[model samples]
Target chain A: MSSLDIRNLEIHVEGKPIVKDFTLNVPKGEVHALMGPNGSGKSTLAKALAGHEDYQIVAGEASLNGQNILKMEVDEIARAGLFMAFQYPSEIPGVSIANFIRAALTARLADNEELDAARYYRRLYEKMDLLKIDRKFTARSVNEGFSGGEKKRCEILQMAMLQPHFAIMDETDSGLDIDALKIVSHGVNTMRGPDLGILLITHYQRLLDYIVPDKVHVMWDGRIVRSGGKELALELEEKGYDWVKEEVAVV
Target chain B: MPATIEQETTNHSIDFDREVGNFKYKEDYSYDAGTGLNEDTVRYISGVKDEDEWILNFRLKALKVFESKPTPTHWASKDLESIDYSKIRYYLSKGQQPSRSWDEVPDDVKETFERLGIPEQERKFLAGVEAQFDSEAAYSNMKARLAEEGVIFVGSTEGLKEHPEIFRKFFGKVIPTGDNKFSALNSAVFSGGSFIYVPPGVHVKQPLQAYFRINAENFGQFERTLIIADEGAEVTYMEGCTAPKFETTTLHSAVVELVALKGARIQYITVQNWSENVFNLVTKRGMAMEDATIKWIDCNIGSRLTMKYPGVILKGRRARGEVLSIALANNGQHQDTGAKMIHAADDTTSNIIAKSISVGQGRSTYRGLVQIPKHLKNCKNNTECDALLINTNSRTDTYPAINVRGNRNSVQHEASVSKVSTEQIFYMQQRGLSEAQAMSLAVNGFVNDLIREFPMEYSVELKRLIDLQMEGSVG
Candidate 1:
């Protein structure tokens, strides 16, 4: 069974603390949701876990299946069965989506092994179809001149293709309409099974409504203040962030 | 003198005014340029060639004109003053005769050409090849099929001997030696370059390439090339150049003239990867007659300094010219290349696109000229020049001269210079590519549109060269 453990994690960006003493664990066969408001450090926790260069890990420990992720490089952390779907994905012009994904997959293969173009295309078309994406998108540059909905869907497509042990999706529902959210959630839901674990970071309960999680935690000021079952998301959404602030202040 | 001879004499006079004497080869063959230019050198060269009295007198007169002409003073790069005429060994020949087979050539010279992949390319792709060692072609060959088709491929010296009438008619018409300082030098001692003639209504599909190599030190390579495509014919020619790196710089001055007759099309492509120790100054021009087309596809990858401007003259109504060029200047290189188009007939059109990449203090400049005479009722021109600087130390300059004398002509010119931003590199590295790989990808993308014009093999080779240039370039 695969597992990820974060203990006493503290993150800083530009000399300011963002994620402080945050601890979480998700083993295989389960999905966890970290719900919080704006400026609550949830996204910071996700990025720092993914080894983003901009986020400095101060006094924290992150391990992926017994390997210290914090000690690895960005690409090394990625190839080590840890995937992070960014909130604002960068647009790389002149690099086609097909070639981008192919390079990533090529990196995962052994040095002597070669990617079979025929089989690769067949599988790519199948996943794109499942996500309701046109096959012509393979020729277009990666996320270049793409709509917000297309970008989010492309992120999900990458997660499905990479098939990591644990994925941290940050604000996957941002800027998506009802139909896009359903399609994106469906792609993630189809990939869910006993061999995968997901940490879904969202500012609202709208995304959890589609891809139901096994556990939900309310985070305030970089720390988880409340924990419950999936229904916790609905209650938080109804009561708004003020309720979380009041609950945390009382605690 | 007869009217024809008088006209010829006047043409020679004008040529002499613009260039140095052509007898530099003859003098070197006999007495050599003794310390400096003198009447003895001119007489010795004319004596060796066994030229007519009129030709001898023309050389003497051209020598006088060359002596009177002053050196150019307005060069932007002040380093031109370092070329000492007296110090330069004008010409040298390994053999008195041009060999028809590679086996008959000299050993050292043949080995030099063979090591540069000339023989391999000739065996695989070319229908003919003229290999020049110094001032003369050491070996030349043409397929029997092409000979049967009346395709004449020979050395320029052979052209001067066998086809004097055609050679004399158009030799100095396109670009006279007086056009530039280097042209003057080339005219004085120019020796071996490819001379191709496609008979009327016969098309030569394969390329006719020439390989020029500089073996000896303090030597100069002045090769003169002429290509004429007859009516209803098509030809594509490619020329490649190389030289062994030497401590003292070698001068390579070449003059190339092309003529495409009515309804004819000619595409001239050059991939110059000269070592970064040679001064390559070449003047190549073409005249497109009525209903003809000319295209120049040039790629400059390595050279200490190269100044090449391939020009096209639209002499016939509805003639067209286009040039797609890419120049990559690595360390200690300066690539100054562009195209020139002169529209003289109605309904003429020309297009020029140039791209350059500068890295590690390497400099690149685009110097282009487009002219449409007032007499031409309807003419069009479109010029685009783009420069990409790889580092802050590198620089690029664009000097485009657009002269439209008639109101009916349409001219468009656009230029942009940009340096590869750090943001671009960071973003690419974030996608898992190395810094070097990212730089290469960005450079490739910058010139992707122009590179698509090359053949598959050439495009692959160009990418490999660019990758080599980008390796270890990041700080």
Candidate 2:
């Protein structure tokens, strides 16, 4: 079993601290929902975890399965079973989705071992079918000219194919309509198993309604101030983030 | 470095102004034809090659045609009077045979090719690579698997010697020596360009590459290349050229002929980044048989004056031809390149797309031609030429001639010339990418359609090339 541990991590953007003393741990077979208001350092945490160059880790440790992920390159961190579904993924022109995934898979192969093309296509088709993606999506350039729903579906498709041990999905439902939300939720739900741990970071509880979480944590400022059962998401949805902001201020 | 080597090389031609001047080649490789144009120079060149009596007479005959043929006075900035044929070294070889193994090469020439990443590429990605230094191929390599498939890759000289029958049949069929003055020059002294032959039904998945390096100044490096794809065969050939910067100019004239047999497909890609003091004039043309396809992808980045037009003759029904060109001309450079397509049979299709980037007093021109006979039916031709000027002093011109005698032929020509506006730069800078990166991206986007046709590895290299060229380009 694999787990991700973020302990006392401080992240800075442009030399200004954004995520201060933030700590979160998700063990294997757990779903953790991070609920935060806008500008509450939610995206900063996601960027920091994904090793984005802009987000500098000034202090603290981020590890995956006892391996120091901060020491790894972005691609290495990805191949090491840490998947971050970007809020705004880059559109690499002239590189199709199939090629991108093929490159990622090829990078994981041993020096002498060759990728089984037949097996790769079979698995890719199966994952695409599960995610309700058109087979033609493989030939399309990554994220180029994709709609909001298509981008979200593409993200989920990548998540499904890569089969990471832990996934940090940042606002997967943002800009997604109801149908897209259902499709995306279905994709995430299909991947849920004892071998997978999910950290779903979202602004609204609507996505939580579809892919019910195991735990909910409300983030205020740069830290998670409150933690509760699944009922916490419902409470926050009804009361809204303003209540959390006031509650954190009183504390 | 050494006196004899330096003197024999004639390393410096010095400043002779804009006019091509008299500078005799001191190299022993040159066969003297005396002071004026005569039968002796032609006879001397033919005797050096030990050509067939018929070929020697053909050279003698071509000399008359060369004397009678008029210079291309219609083309802009073509001062043919400046080129002094007597001064140039027609051919020079340092006695190095094209070696299949790197260890067999001479140390100095081997070091030159090694610095340019020749043998290393052969070991990694290239299925076969021919490295030509000056006038002779120094090294050649082909993977064992490709050799077993009966795909022949060798120097043109070896092709002439080993495969005489095949070489004799198609030597000058597509672009004869009398086609142009440069072609005539190349025919007179051509030495070591790649010769490729793909066997019937064989598809070479990896591209066979050739790298030509010119290290001697005032010396003319004329290489001849011939690639034939047999019936139902498919192959891709890539060629790259580079030279060192010199105060004196060097000359490089090459002739490349390709034949795609019935139902065959051939793709020829050239990325020429010659030094800013080389006159790169090359003639490349191909012939396509019934249902065959031929493509030429040429990218010219740097040269003092480069005039190359890779053309195709669709001689059989349902044949197809395509040319995608990207020319980037910087200061003191003039890149004049385009394509030509001739449809002789019914239902032939051709497409020509050329993009040019000019910066800092550079001049680039696209001169293209497409012709369809009166009897041919349903011939289609689409030509698009675009130019991007990076500065006020930079200039670009487009001259496209489409002659479709048949009523059924459909031809389209579109052209646009635009300068990189400061507003776009400001807008892109507001985003993350820098000015150079933005310019590079824009230039890449202009040719993105053509770039998509390249393999992934080549596309990356092409992007990096554009980025390197865009550095310090912003005003």
Candidate 3:
């Protein structure tokens, strides 16, 4: 299928179950918001999908556009058109943002192909403009001493530059202020189209108001407990997460 | 200028700075000092130059010092003992007096430089071929202009014979023979380096590049270089260090001395990438007079064991000194390098920034010494050394000796040893770089600021070496 299909994904961290029986399908041209409370394994699922070493994929299958991503290395999965915008983007002190993004783009090219430095810088500046980042930011070290909102916007900038088939934004809106959230959401919204799918994992309904996901799924205890349309986010936000826990208890 | 964003001034300039270079040519020498170190070896070398009695006496005294001092083992790796001083061929040459013009250079040597992809102007001086690239008219114009300005730039042998008034004054004075055992050895049998003298009050705009390449196998080992900047003059010099890969050549020890006179400035840069199995133990130091400045930017890669610590002695009031260096050690290699700043004058200042990366089973050590003695006033020193380890077995060590005992003197020394953070690599990989690429990026970032100080050509080579080393180590 032309989609990000993760089936029966079981993940563990340090031999402890973190994500269990996690199944989700985000097809092309769709934006799915995975909402969950703290410690509900939302970030772990994203890390495992991104092939992080610490997040062990004990038993599972994850595919991006019919390509088995679970069998790929972190970079290979990324090259397979799966993008992960980390909640805390690493502060690589000496690597410039422009060079980092260019490397990522270069890795996607076939052998003997070179990335045009001028064109790469031009495209990078455009993304930075879209994210309200300064042109000087490209020369600055990646996320070095960046404020919270700037880090989120930088993550969005990278997502826009890579233009992957599927992107998992893990709590991208967590640290952002209102203005930054608006800019970052605008950048993401500009990328939303028939060719792209997104799994926006977040805790608040604040971000939903800006981007408005096509589908909303509430995760509890390492699994998706409820799935519904866009209104589900508002309902959950209004009733609070304790409401879902008590309902699960009653069930 | 930082030279960080300097656009390449020429296209083909960096093509030669690519790898632990493998290009070689057949060896045909007419003059051979044979293998080994002895009084006769020293005598033979002095006789080859047909030097004065004083010079011969200097060599004889240095020979005694070289034999008297034991191998440095207190702080050096045990690998220092493996070099059989006798087995190393002391000298080899084609027996041709270096023609005063590039056109007179041997055809084979020219062809070798051409095959090595050496640029035209670089090739001429690299072979001690007299810096004449007639085909490159613009370079000739610069050379003529420099000559008109009374600047003296020539091979060391030519400088000593023709302009002894200037060359002899500062020779062996900045770094004496007893400085180290290797220095003593180089003092006895030195060859194949440059002598540059900038006149008073003149500013050389472009950097002067001179080569003491171990290009021909066993052709040159102990190279001696000296540069003198007179009052209020300034110059920048680049020493290109390269060796054709082979099994025979093993030892390379060079002694370089720089003198920046009153109110002058001198910047010396060296980018050395020797072939495998080469032991590059070099002694380089500069002396700064009143209100003068001396800066050394060094980058070391590709040798089996490199122990180089470029130093400066600030002897004049208000003098300044700096050493910015980067070293990369790959598998089966050890890069033991650092810097030393000795402030002997009042109100002098110095800054030392050193960064190194160790890949696979390689090891890097930063051994620095900053001495502001008990009597200097208002002297300040800042030393920052950072190391990055690429693999689990990769190693790095920092041994800094900062002695600032005097009143009104300040010294700051900061050292950090870090491994390439797995999270950082993962983050980079998640965006799509291979593990090796990711690791190399982390390393480049670690040494980014220092690389900026290197000339664009050397920085490009430095980055390529890092990438190649990472590719081999990370799978």
Candidate 4:
């Protein structure tokens, strides 16, 4: 079984530590929710694990399915079965979503081996339908001038197509309306199975209502201060983040 | 932080230099006018062509004009000062007539065009083909169906000899010998370029193509082309050019004139991929009559320095013109290209869109002009220039001169300068693309809109060229 393991990790941005001594282990067949407020190093951890050059890994280790992703390049980390769904997807003007996904899948092939175009398009159309995306959306530029809901749906669509061993979803619920949120949750739920592991990051507890997480971790400052089962998310939602600050102060 | 990004761009630009160089071909010239240009060179070229007295006089007058005019000092780049006119060979050719069959041409000459996929394209898509080797066309042919439609496609020399009634009337009328210094030079010693004429109300469905190859060292290629689309006729013409890599500088000066009569439509396209040692200076202009349409689509890549501005004159009421061009300047190259629109009649409209990319120490500039007189009522013009700089040393500039004399005329000009964002590259990398692939995709996207304007086959070829250039730059 595949798993993503982070051990005593410390990440810094511009020479300042953001995520300190963070540890998390997500095995296949389960989903873990990482709930944190703004500037709590949630996005920093995601970027660091994705091998972004700006997020410096100071005294940290991240491995995906027994492969040390920290030693690999950004593209290599992606090809090593780790995916990071961005909070703010970049706008690639003139590049269609169909071509982008095709390139990603083509990268996974062995050298000199070409992807089967007919089969690839068939599978792509199927996944796009499952995500409720119109076939015309494939011709539009990647994330260019897309609404908040469309961007989130696009990220989930990519996750479904790439079928990575582990996916780190960063703020996939932000800016999405109720209808869009349900559609996005449905797409994510449809992809969930015994072979996939998901790290769902969110600021509010609303996302948990749709896709129930097996584990919930409260991230304060730079580390996870509390962890529990699914009901903990509801209790934290009712108590508010101020309660977590006070509890951490007491600790 | 900006400095770091510039450094990365510089490192990537070196990769392109490694990818394109050292392409050479064997040279065989039966007649070489030798280096230098003067009355003797002009007289020799005229004598070899056995031209009429009027044509010979025209060459002499143009030679005098070329001698009187000096190279402009106020260009976007001062590389023009390095060109030595006396060191340039005015004419070089195999001294053979153009053949309609590929087997009749010499093997070496045929192989060059074959490698460039000329014959295959002619068979598959083109209605006619004209392949120029150095100073003269080596092979020229048109389909029988097109000939039956009264479409005239032949070398300029053949056109002048056989179709004097049409050739003489519009020969130098659109672009005169004194239009520019390069035009004057081309008028004096010009040799093999395509001459096409479409009959009235006839439409040539497939494109007519010409391929120009310069194989000799220090040789100069001056081809004069003229196309006349009669009233209500429609046609599309395309040309591609290349030269062998050499240490000594080569010169390519061409002059092209198009006349679209009343209600006629003509589309002219050129793709120039010269070697870095070649200096490409060209003058192309078209005249659009009442309700006529003229369009110029140009793509420039490679060459040490290129100075070309294709222009259109809307000389009659309701005439239309458009210019869509793309230029890429790699290391040690400068592309100074743009368009000119002149609205001389009522209800005339024109549009210009130019895009350029500068990598390493390369430079690109957009120089354009638009003129609308007070007498012209309801004239409109739009111009857009976009520049992409790939490194700190890469540079771009825009100089637009617009003269609208009437209050009823409307002219809009827009320009933008941008670099490939690092964030975009990072984002693509997160999707499993390598750094080079990411940069290539971004560059392709930057010009994607303009590329779509090209014909299907040319657009595909352009993408492949861009991919190769990107790989070299990033390597």
Candidate 5:
């Protein structure tokens, strides 16, 4: 039951099909790389599974830990242990990072229960120290005036605090430079364990060089065209996605 | 156009009912001036208090002015026509005496104030406390230490009789009867508000608090408050008003005046939570002298229609004034609130920041006025007003009139109206918060800076009031 499974999932954006027959499954304790070029529907699939209102799910089923996720509301789905790190997270002005994460944690509590402030700060500081984020960042507003690298680190910081069962990293490596990439990759590698299954969506194989995935799947034309080990990423990087397109065409 | 009057049944509901200022006890009155507003009603009230001849003439003259002027129908809301002046009880009180101790107060009155958490708050932080029920102050007391420093804090009636040398000078000077129709009515029938005077260089460290409660049906509560801080003195005064829900409409019109002399400071704060059946029309203005500072921290949460624009008149060189306010308007309510700054001398400065949140069909309007005459120099003002509309039906408007004639003066004004974005709401929702909780969080974020300007206890209570009003607001 501790797994993420998507079975023949079909999705449309503004009445046009963007993800077709997306079938994948990742058991807990594994990292899966969803590799694709631009417009290959990797991000659309993540948003659809997370129940974003703009994404339409035409057919098929998506479940997490034996619970149907796409059938629930957005917040309910999140409470059922799903987290998405946006490529461009919003800037919540006037709300500090400490308060924002506290609100999220408070929402997870029962009606009669309350969050222990001292305990929460202790755990938050521990995570921030591990991620190498400055202690003063706690007082700063969430992603407000943050650089691209800082925003991604903030997302990982939230993930570390929330402790979600499964996470979808939507291009977490898109806007980072080489040095920032190393720090972020180290964070992802540290968060990896049997308790959390991750679907890492990326266009290039540069990220896999740092945090190697257990399996890699290539997507093209809104469908998965190839499935292989980490070596497939290097092969695609060498021969490029054109070879996969021709191979799929020949099939 | 004088609109017709009709009694509309209470239709829509839900703004923190039953638990927060929604229960009223029976009324036991020793004096009632009957219904209607006339010369006889004014005379009857003046006679009950055994007022001076000059005070009686002032009341009678104000009653004439009240009858002569009309509601500003051409510019005001149509809801103003719903108020029936002939059917309202003008005056009602148990007695003119305000007990100096809670033990001497009536049981029902003491129970009412206790339930509202008055005495506890007084004991916790206040330097002085005045609890007013219906038409008179039930209990008024100040710390003995403060009294030892020659600080005068008492009901307006007692102040008028005991300290006329100081009270008679600035009684109605700031906001006279003919200033507006409501002010005229309040001047004619004003009762149990606070009167405070701090001596020169005598600083009151803790705030003096007054809590006003309305307990009778179809009665109008008109209180008058005045405070004068002598040269080099500093004081902060806070007041709260609450009333129970009733089927008929209730009117609450008050006039408050403040004076900060040279090198002095005065801060006036109000946290009002009137029921949906009340119409709160108030006039509040302060005067700041040379090198003095005056600040108004107002938070308006509940009422049927509230029209208050707390203003400041800078009357001396190097004087400063500031007004920071937050308002939350729920269904069937309209908050027409803003600020005014009048620069009367050179080197005067003022700043105004107002924020409002409109939920459901509620409406909020920000009307500000800033004036600097051509002869004045080095006058500056900065005005900003922001509004948040919760849903599609929720509405907000802003009208700022700024006039700076002299080339040496500088003024800046900014206004913005934004709706709660679905994306922002969804972002908070995806963080595991319900829709209403998410909305409340965003609103609190919108007004977070102004909330910090409030005192510790009021800020907490204000946040709770905002959360309570945000219930059932999500469409």
Candidate 6:
């Protein structure tokens, strides 16, 4: 069983601390929701966990299946079974979606072992179909000129294809319509199984209604202040973030 | 992120020096007209080819023209001034006629081309193949079906001697000897370029390919090519060139002229990967008649300095012209390439798309010209030049001269210079590609649109070549 374990992680951007004393763990077969207000450092934590160069880790330990991921490169971290669905997917002009995914899969293979193109395409098409993405999109450049919903769906498509041990979806619902949100949620639900863990980071609690996280945590000022079950999301939605700020102030 | 965030970095200049390989070949030249160019050299070259009197006289006149004209000094790069005419071997040949079969070729020459995969490519897709070693063609062959269809493909010397009636009329009409200094020099001692003629109403479905290799030290390769397509005919010609590395500088100057008659279409493609010590200066132009089309697809890589601008003249009503070029300049190289389009008739159209990449301390320049005179009616022209810089020390420049005087003519010119973004690199790296692979993919992506215009086999080879160039470019 694989897990993403982060303990006492302190991340800084340009020498200014953004995520301080952050600790979270999501084991396989469970989903965790990270709800935070703006400037709460939720996205910072996600990017830092993915080994973004700009997000300097001051003190932290992030392990993937007993492997120290914080010491690895960004790509190494990814190959170690951690996936981050970006808030903004980059537009790689001229690189087809098929080629991008193939490159990722090929990287995981041993040297001198080539990815079987036919099998790879079959799997890719299956995942693409599950996400309601057009089959013609396989030949299109990755996320180039794609609509907002399309970009989000593409990220989910990548997460589904990679089938990582843990996936951190950052604002996967932003810029998505109700139908797109439903499709994305369905994709996420389909990928959630005994071997995969998920951490959904969002500013709003709306996404929680669809994914139905096993645990919900409200973060304030770079640290999680409260944790509860699924009902906590609806309660926080009704009470608004001001209540969380007051609660954190009392703490 | 803002909709449009301009993140411009100040250019950081750095010095870069790369050691070029010094690979040489040991072979006997049956005929070697020693170094230096003069009337004697031109006469000797003509005598060796056993050309007609008019051809020899033409060469002698061109020799005078070459001597009179000075090396161009106003270009973006001053590498032209360094070419020493006296140090260059004017001509060398293996003293054997071009053979129709590979078995008939000299053993050493055949082995060289076999290693370069010329014969294999011909067997797979080409309708004909012409392999030139040094100054003369060592092997030339065409499919029997093509030969039976009245299509003529052979060396220029053979074409002139065997079919002068057809070859003489249009030989230098498209590109005159006095067109440029290099053209003049090429005309004086030119040898071993492909000569093709397509009959009217006949289409050659497969491409005819030519491979040129320069093997001697301090050698100068001056090949002259002429292609003519009759009315309603269509054909495509492709050329590939490479040279062995040498400590001393080598010069390659060629003149290629194409004539597309009424309703005919001709496409010319060149993929040049010369050694770093070679100076490649070429003059290529095409003339399109009524309702005809001419297209030039040129790719330039390697070579210490290259200045080539393939152009077309739309001389008849409703004629069309296009030039698609991709130039890559690695360390210590300069790729100065672009296109020229001349609209001389009403309803003529032309298009130019040029993409260039500069790696390390290399420099690439887009120098182009488009002219639509005042009397031309309903003429249209579009030109786009894009440059990608791969390093902090790399540089690029654009110089486009668009002259549009006609009121009804439509002209559009667009040029862009962009450096490979760090975000792009990081994004690709996140997908598990190494820095070199990411760089290669991004560079390939930048020119992907234009590369699609190439034939399938060429596009694949071009990508492989770019990948090799980008392997060690990033630290």
- After superposition on all C-alphas, the RMSD of every candidate to the true structure, in Å, is 9.9, 11.4, 3.6, 5.6, 6.7, 6.2
Writing each residue's lDDT as its tens digit, candidate 2 over B83-158 gives: 6666665556665357878999877777776666667667666788998877778888888898899899999878
Deviation from native of the Cα of residue B300 in model 1, angstroms: 2.0
- State, as a TM-score between 0 and 1, how close model 5 is to the true structure: 0.94
Best by DockQ: 3
lDDT of 4 at A53: 92
The local lDDT score (0 to 100) that residue B254 gets in candidate 2 is: 92
Q: What is the C-alpha lDDT of each candidate?
A: 0.78, 0.79, 0.83, 0.88, 0.88, 0.88
Q: What is the TM-score of chain A alone in each candidate?
A: 0.98, 0.97, 0.98, 0.98, 0.98, 0.98
Model 4 interface DockQ: 0.40
Residue A60 alpha-carbon offset, candidate 5, angstroms:
2.3
lDDT of 3 at B59: 89
Docking class of 1: incorrect
Q: How much is the lDDT of residue B419 in candidate 3? A: 83
Model 6 TM-score (B-chain only)? 0.95
Q: For candidate 5, what is the DockQ?
A: 0.38
Lowest summed lDDT over 10 consecutive residues: which window, candidate 5 chain B? B1-10
- The DockQ of each candidate is 0.16, 0.03, 0.69, 0.40, 0.38, 0.33
Least well predicted 10-residue stretch by lDDT in candidate 2 chain B: B13-22
lDDT of 2 by residue, A160-192 (tens): 877888899999999899988998999899899
Q: Best candidate per TM-score, number? A: 5
Q: Number of clashing pairs, model 5? A: 0
* lDDT, model 5, position A94: 71
Q: What is the TM-score of chain B in candidate 5?
A: 0.95
Q: What's the iRMSD of model 6?
A: 7.8
Instruction: Give Cα distance to truth, residue A74, candidate 4, Å.
Output: 2.0
Segments of candidate 2 deviating more than 4 angstroms: A1-251, B1-45
Q: What's the TM-score, to 2 decimals, of chain B in model 2?
A: 0.89
